[model samples]
Target chain A: MRDWRYWLAEQRGTLIALAIFALMFTIYISNHPAGLTTNVAQTAANKGTLLALVAMAQTLVVITAGIDLSVGAILVLTNCIASMVVTGNAFETTLGVVFVLFVGALCGALNGLIVIYGRLQPIVATIGTGAIFFGIALILRPLPGGTVNETLADAMTGKVFGIVPASLLMLLAIVLVVWLPFCSSVIGRAAYAAGSSETAAYMSGMPIRRGKFAAYTLGGLLASIGGLFLTFFTYSGQASSATASTYTLLSIAAVVLGGVSLFGGRGSAIGAIFGAFAFRAIGDLMFVFDFDALWQPLFQGVILLLAVSIGALGLWRVRNRLEWFG
Target chain B: MSDTTMGRLSERMPRFIRRIEPPVAISFACIILLLLFGGLYSSAFLSADYLLQQLKVASFLGVIATGMMLVILLGQIDLSVPWVVAAGAMMACAATAYGPAATLAAVPIGILCGMLIGLINGIGVAYLRIPSMIVTLATNAVAQGLMVVYTGGFSPRDFATEEMRYLATGSLIPGVPNALIIWAIVGAGMVFVLTRTTFGRAVYGIGNRERAAYLSGVNTRRVVMIAFIAAGGLSAFGGVLLAGYASKAAQGMGDAYLLPAIAAVVLGGTSILGGRGSYLGTVAGVILITLLLSILSVLQMPEAGRQIIYGVVIIAMLLLYGRSPTNQ
Candidate 1:
């Protein structure tokens, strides 16, 4: 019980966000019992999984005090590349997926290299690269429509167990395989150190440049995974797949709300996952209420503001309490 | 010893060339490149009419860039410019509809609205002790939200009057645009303000060392507020001209300006981390960007290619300037 309490205390923000999610989910179920069925569950699972992948990518960069505005563009570019390469054959499709992921990593490495070697500010540099990536995506797939193999899409989106969605299974696998090691490793600690104080970290021999480069490269890799998942869910790759640039901002908000400081040096992969789920639940709740699309931007902005402020206040209070003890 | 002294003098000459080279030579190179492309691609590109049109388009961005430059000079930023521009245009359009008197009233109202937002940003940063980036970003969101609620994503119809049209499309000289003239006047005025005024000196001082300036009896907060207000007013002016040019304001029109304005400031040899800059450099930067766009248009490049190149050029410029420690 004591151990559990300590764990819960460490993740208070995530716990609170999860509690809100549960409340929202209960309301959603009460409003639309039909939406509680298998189909809706699977749909939510698929969409949430994809969004979580993108959020994870964003989280990696944000944890290092850098932001990758190019995520959406990279997603589009990867999706387009996948569409061009995958021609419905099972073997070909697998190859295409691998190719897309590789491309995504390559693109991310370019951004990381520029940031590290070129010594460009992350925001400005990424915005520029984002524009270039977006342009390339447009050139590759000039319009909205490319087909994905139905079988592959179905396999990814379908149930893996009696009731568990395949997407959930994929999410679990990814969490176990990629995130666990990455978050606990020396490299990750270096990322935290760099974010806290680059100059100090450099003085401490933390390999600051390498850490930033790795973070960005990882961000790109995660975004590509997101693109692949998005393709499976939609069963298509469109040029305008990532039209919502505001998603990047929302992802940042989610990270911050999950108790991740915008200044970086403090956050968790688990917290980011919870933040993603919380955001998804909020959107779902709004839909259940039948709010118009016009209200989306306003609602998102307000929620983001509220969430960030609450998180900041909570952190301040915690620090104040700790100071009292000292 | 004399030979060593002569060698050192020659070495310093190259260093001097390198120092003066970037702003003047780069802009000249870009202009020459644009002229070359224009000469080769299209006969119409060299005409005074084409040049004037490009100048007019450049003016809208130039005005905002000038204000942005001031904020940059103060070692801060205002991300709220986009929505402020939208709000300014919306307010102007709203005023224009009620009556001619109302339309005239909009000028001050637009300036005041911008000033109010700027003051809020300044207070948030200076007194409340918030980071400028986050504060301005939040204000941008609020402004954008308000703009959407008020305008409903459509251009307000009130700004279609003869006066508005004159402001947008009319020429002061037979071929030269009125907007270009306005841009020149604003640029000259700002240059004078920055160099001649005590407030300008204080801005540079504050940028150099806020703590030192504060100790030296400079009203740092007020100066910062004035800088933001000036930026806001300038952005509003850009918005007014944009409405005049298009005959209406649209959603996200201001978004496209964000990068270009910042780029112009950077390209003008202004440091992103602040402390050293010149209006002349910004003027050159604006011309370079405008010329680049004009050249791309003349080349008949696709929108995607143009966008890609735009980002690349800006990044390249930043990298080049950022590496030169002297700029810092």
Candidate 2:
């Protein structure tokens, strides 16, 4: 009833990302002494979930032909906020969580305002905002210590029904709530159009600016969501510049590995999530194999190079040299 | 604030000195204002020694930002600067551990290591047609990973050699530090290359439009590859200078320079989008940033406050002239 080729083409990036994750996860779990247990899966899922959320955030901006270097800072900022506010009683915790998410969205909205209305490049604007966000976080937690609601943190970090990782479930809920709705919305399609060709999108009278604004704002929100999760996982927050920068860099890598074109206008958040998982799996493979922790960075980097390089393999098939620019 | 005033200045200025674009002129003005601003706090801020100290420090960033400007001119970027810089300092220092011969050859060897990373970056961006951003990013991570593996998470025990130390800290010409001389040399070379050489023209050409440049038979790929390689080597050289200044290489030493280097480049009026900018603008930019950082520190601002100021200043400076908005 349906054209399988079209479906395959549409889902190619996601399928490839999923395959990569599955392959790497298999190798990782196989190498571990404990084999494939719920505990191991839960740990892996819990760790991978942070990067997945950030990568998802990056995906929205990338789809709009812009990059957000501030996502990590936003996450860190939200984490710091959550650490301070997400305490007291259950109602208080819930209120704090809402406040944190709001702050995240507010940060994203600021980024959107600067880029869309101030008419600045996204890269530099985000870099500026990133520094601001990190500074704010530093002010909030200068010494790297703050507390979140312990019960909430434990539950969020724990397994669901003694099997599935609760963090992963929350991540899925986010994808459903944040990404799917935005991906199918008029503004989201406008974002894709803008990314593919901004001039065309604008010429067609599409709401390109509004779409981009939504993307940047959503990107911030997602980063904050990731930040909240970080708070839950750690039960604390620290404004480490290293963490901010690392997450930002790795998120870009994850987006690329997820099959999103850095050139913009292509790919999905789910693909990015899988890409993040694959990246996490690649990093953890060293631990399972008993390699020194020192070797992890090099190992992760080499695997990332290989993964991103594979995408470049498609260029060789092009007959015209001009398409390389395209 | 307005291009109309800028147009008048260029029109009024002599053709020979026209390289000082409006943004560059504005940057120079900012430097003067910054000095005055600092003078209001402490008379020592305008003192020769203090100014000289700032100049010496700016030299390191000046050298590194030179490489970044080259890449930015090509409409690409090299995020690998930070780690490549560490690799340079680390490799140079590590080479000294191998006996006298390696010690003597350390500087070149360190730079060569960076160039090697640049080679991979160049190949990926050129032959493989990968986006410069992602490729440089991958190389940066790989460089960091390799460095970590080499050091095993500890700072290198090998101290910076006397040559590097002298180059960084010693003043051969009585008043000027060797680092300043090196920057002057590099800066002069950059100016000449950008204004006089065909390679420079090709960089601008490719950056403006890669396809058009390719069709014009400019060997666009080779030019891009060389730019990345040069950027890598220069970044490493900057790292070498930094190690010399500090007497040893520490883990993540390069991290501090990345943002400052980029900010300096953009502040100098070079378009982040590429194809337009000048060396003098960058020189003014380096000094401006150095003074700004100095004044901020002298004020005893907290790190977070300083960071906020730094970010704000960059955005404000860019807003002044770096207004090359993306497509409609």
Candidate 3:
């Protein structure tokens, strides 16, 4: 195969996710009462972007062959904090945003510390931290009422030039600023190398710990971004456990659908973004068809199962049955 | 005793102590320490009535943890547990309107519902080669949706039968809760299977390394399926008992149990990575957790604080025992 062919092979998962999202959105738009107008697109973009940011966060940690179960909790925690602090004057809101991002990084750092120094499995470690984060969230907004700066929330969530979504632009900017640089950096490659084979990476003198730590910290920052958007959209913070768990679960599904290998070392945040969009569409599709909201989980579950099962297709191609266990 | 005799005793103790798994020893110590703390908190804490109540509470967690242990032993996880528990309880409760015989059959039928879900989980993981985590999670969501559609997002109206209520809240022997008796019986059976059965041996082998187990003529797929099936059934059984305790099953009642079940298993010295652990350690863990939680409630700590404690305790325990020399 040519070099570009290999690139295509590498990008297959992301491409599939994009295609899936495009197809779903097309169907959604055509079936919609308002069609593909700015209002419809903006509404969809705003909802999808929240999940995309979190899915992007999950993508980073997953690239290091580690899963952060606390992403949604961090989102909730930051949302709660932002509700209290991201208010008052413009300067105060800016400071709140920065502070919320810092809090997220700190949470991610804590997870990395425990996983590395404590030598604990990432899954177990994150589960514990997730609970801790949710606990903090519950304390922050024991009641669901708090305000965000309407000026900021409106600008971010509103349409740009009445044609394109501001949220979509923001997501694009994040991809360029956060993901692209990380993808090309030495640390990012190291993270991938470690995920693929830690022993090899370590033996090659790669800074595996630093790489994974960066992935986790960046993951936290991204999730906080999701939280910020969530606060903007809802105009308040509610420490809803249902929302937290659902987001966490859906982000994983998005990551998988985006063609990011759960086994680690491959895939992209871009793919995950598309995966998130595609996943959100699954719910919207139900609405367009006038299906009851009760059917949403079932549809999401089936799609997730089918998408994940695609990853398992390789098992059939394995000549040795032993490889199936791997 | 002389100083020389004390020195000799100390010198010999490490060798004996080394034979006991660190998590097992630590959990037992925690149980004792917590009991001491409980006694200090109130005179009622040291009484048999209070302790027995604690045991009764622990039994619910114990049953769920037993299934969790089996899945973890196979180097897999079952996130489907929450909904499986719900499904069992909901279906069993729904079955109660038929007649007396149906009420008696409700328990088995509930477990069977869980078993069917487990079979699907098994097929996905074993035959399809999907990761257990994703497969089970997907199933959990599916189960949730199904239950929601069935119940129309409300609590199932059917109540637990007298039999179930008796099993959960009634005492089988004087001063002994029937729930505890049930847990003990289940624990005893699990211990026997782990220590003596070929199936047990296969589970350990697969956990240690599945490829090697497969090559060694162990029916790895079959074993994995059976383990998951058993886990599903047990979780359902726990839910049924919980329903009885509450007098009715509610949507999402099983949600709180998932993490606690995982915590109990890991705290009991069972490796989350699989292939290691003991039922005795789990018993200690269940008791310790229950006692700690009860005391936390007694302290009037808010729900948020209690959650924080649970999370912190799990991580702390992991740091103490989750590590192995080979992994690092």
Candidate 4:
């Protein structure tokens, strides 16, 4: 039907991302020492889930046409916070999780306030806040040693049944809980409008600032969720600048791979999720193919450049040079 | 403390006199405050040698930030700075294995690598129309990978050539560091370009509005390309000096420059959105940051405290003057 064609066009990026993930995963599993095993699936799912959450966070901000360089800082800070407070009994752990999420949302809100009211560019403002967050994280966890509630961590990271990964299920739950509602809400439309064209959005009386604020706030919340997962997976937290920079870079790469336009307002977190998975698959392929670990960064970089170039190919069709700015 | 008095005072200042911008003035004032504060810890903070030593260090950042300033003025960014810098250092060092005569070609070879990286960045941004941020970042990752593979490990084995060493650390003039003199020459060139040249005017015009600039017959794409290429090359040159200063290149050597360079450019009252900044502001910013770091160390602050203070100070400075209404 014509309606399905329109729907398919809208869903094209997500589908392509999914296809890429499927293809890479197929290659990875076929070459894996133990092919398609639950352990392998679980391991892959665990790693993919962390990036998926961060990439999903990035997707919200990118959708609003602003980049958050501080996502990695928020993740690192939350992880450090969780490591310290998410200890002892069940009540304490739950409290710690809530607190970490709160801190993340607060960080996002601060970034939004600075951008919206302070009238600063997102790039510099986020860089400053990122440094501040990282500093706090360093103070909180000067060394890499803390414990999460093992029973809860185990349940979260373990397989959901005899087959499916719990981390994957958690990712789905988050999508259902946070992203779906946000996507359907009027705020989401406002965000899309703002990203599409802020002046036009403003003229049309769309709630541009509020929409962006919500996007950034939710971005922080989602990044904190990723941080919690990292603490569970590693069983500790370290204020590692290397990890923070890596996550920030890879998350942006994943968002691009997921087909989210850096220009804004053109893709879904679902696409980003698949993109994160495909990205993880690239690294795993390196592991299986016996490529030296040193080659992974280069391999990933090449893939990222290729993906970005493919996205830019459509621009070649623009007849007017001015459209390049548009 | 009162607005009316300050307004009248500013209004009374003659246009030909070139009144100091509040942000730049405040930065200089902050530098003095840092020195005074450090002076309490040690008399050495006020001494000529200590000040010159700080100046020498600031020159490296000044050189890098000069390139950064040009790109920022054009309303674009080159995030590939880290690896471009690394690649430059490594290439210069790697050339030593070819023998002494080839060593003569090392600096040029290093800078050329940087320009090549810049060319790719420029093409992606100018022609392909990929966002500069994303393209530069991807190239950074690629450069990182290339550097990693080249060294075969965490650190490079080659030593800095004699020319590289002298250029970085040797004094061509009595009592003045060669690096400082190099920075001064580069700064003067930046001033001339940004103020005097058609290319420079095109960069400002494009930053203000690319569509309008194109309509006005400016080659917006070419200007953007050249700005990025210049940025990459300058960043690499900074790296070469760094490698030479240390007598060797190391892994992740450029990692430390990105934030500080950006911070210096902004603190000097350059609008992050683009097309507005003075070279003088950047100079003040560089000195301010260097002094701040020195004072923080003098105070025996930990890295965490230093970082926190650094971030807070930048935000405070920006908040003070960065909110001025646009020229329009």
For candidate 1, give the lDDT. 0.75
- Residue pairs in steric clash, candidate 4? none
Ordered from best to worst DockQ, the candidate numbers read 3, 2, 4, 1
Residue lDDT tens for model 1, B60-93: 9999999899988877777778888877776777
Categorize the docking of model 1: acceptable
List the candidates' TM-scores in order. 0.88, 0.96, 0.96, 0.96
- What docking tier does model 2 reach? medium
In model 3, the clashing pairs are none
The full ranking of all candidates by lDDT, starting with the best, is 3, 2, 4, 1
Off by over 4 Å in 2: B9-19, B153-156, B325-327
Give the range where candidate 1 chain B is weakest over 10 consecutive residues by summed lDDT. Answer: B319-328
Candidate 4: lDDT of B278? 84
TM-score: the better of candidates 1 and 4: 4
DockQ of each model vs. true complex: 0.31, 0.66, 0.72, 0.60
Q: What is the TM-score of chain A in candidate 4?
A: 0.98
Tens-digit lDDT track of model 1 for A258-302: 666667777776677777777777777778789766666667667
What fraction of native interface contacts is shared by candidate 3? 0.68
Better of 1 and 4 by lDDT: 4
Q: Considering summed lDDT, which 10 consecutive residues are worst modelled in model 1 chain A?
A: A317-326
Better model by DockQ: candidate 2 vs candidate 3: 3
Give the C-alpha miss distance for residue B107 in model 2, angstroms: 1.0
